[model samples]
Target: MNVLPQSKHYNLTHYQQRYNWDCGLSCILMILSTTQREQFLNNFEAICKEEGFGSSTWTIDLCYLLQRYQVRHEYYTQTLGIDPNYTQHMYYSKIIDKDEKRVTRKFKDAKAHGLRVMQRTVDMDVIIKHLARNGPVILLTNASLLTCDICKRNALEKFGYAGHYVVLCGYDMDSKKLYYHNPEVQDGHICRCLSEAMDTARTAFGTDQDIIFIYEQQQSSDQ
Candidate 1:
């Protein structure tokens, strides 16, 4: 395991997504906030629309959007392929119901943007390492994983086992706790034990493992 940092955190309360479907967007905003980009902070929805993010957004969509903005980023997943059953369910339930042609076009557009996407099982150690490097991650997990009672209730009522996204901003290795910016919760930030975080992360629809979106901004020569 890598040496964990004592403590790390990012203030991203102002970037909370207004719509339930905008969690991914909210996480993107949180990441951009770290760069202190005012344009993204001021025009979130317009930027979302420009990125072709609809009611239901996928990690891939986010990757493309970040690439368009010249944000160096990648998405990590436990599996290289998506589960057939989950894909069928998403299509049938209209969770990702969209024009096939349009979706294909958007995917191609993202690919052209040169976004880097990687698939691998991630753990607490990896998360902590990233935080130590000052890289915030977009974590995908079930709403039940959150410590807030209201977030769990909302997750149960509105999402119901569906995947959710949050920003992992800090960690306390001494306490074995992970901190995140959860858009669904009232306070927007939650902390949980490492074990609990891992358990709830497996609640996602696919391989029942962890998936994350990470991007580190490149520093300029002038600086």
Candidate 2:
């Protein structure tokens, strides 16, 4: 979280310095490392001191920090270090129908089973409770129409959602936010806002539906 110099002043050497530490090349090269991305402000100040610079800028270099964090996060997830608890939800064509407008009931069934596996780790009630105890749970959601709407219904009817697979790890109730991890960003963009994310997800899945699924949170552990 290094704050960028407000006066457009920068330490060209530190900025361009090649990292020679034990950190990964990406992290060393990147100004803000993902391991410390959450504490970006503090990290920025440290970087300034280490680089023999000062900060007097109106706005910090949040964009760069966010970008670098995204990259490190992706590298962490895709590699063997990905946490098993992290939740991920997505929807794809089930049967590859004539316009691919329909999902195969079989595939949908499998997805529901996957959701069950996720719940086995932590039921929706537990997830909500954890969120209440913790903070806003950052959730990564698959905003596709089939995923957001159809899958839930299918999950309820067929004993589980086969097309929609959800994984739960952390939650935040205050800001009504959920954290999720996805490996889809070209240069360091990851995670999506639930509000607008649903719309974008729907478009990716080829749908005109305005449906947004709400993952309810509870204050009590008792369901």
Using TM-score, give the best candidate's number.
Answer: 1
TM-score of each: 0.74, 0.22
Candidate 1 Cα misplacement greater than 4 A, ranges: 34-38, 41-46, 79-82, 88-92, 99-111, 148-159, 187-195, 206-210, 213-215, 218-223
What does the lDDT come to for candidate 1? 0.59
What is the C-alpha lDDT profile of model 2 across 59-150, one tens digit per residue? Answer: 01111222334421110011121212222322223222221211123123423433211111222443345333332222222323222221
Best by lDDT: 1
Model 1 quality (TM-score): 0.74
TM-score of predicted structure 2: 0.22
lDDT of each: 0.59, 0.26
Off by over 4 Å in 2: 1-124, 130-142, 145-169, 188-223
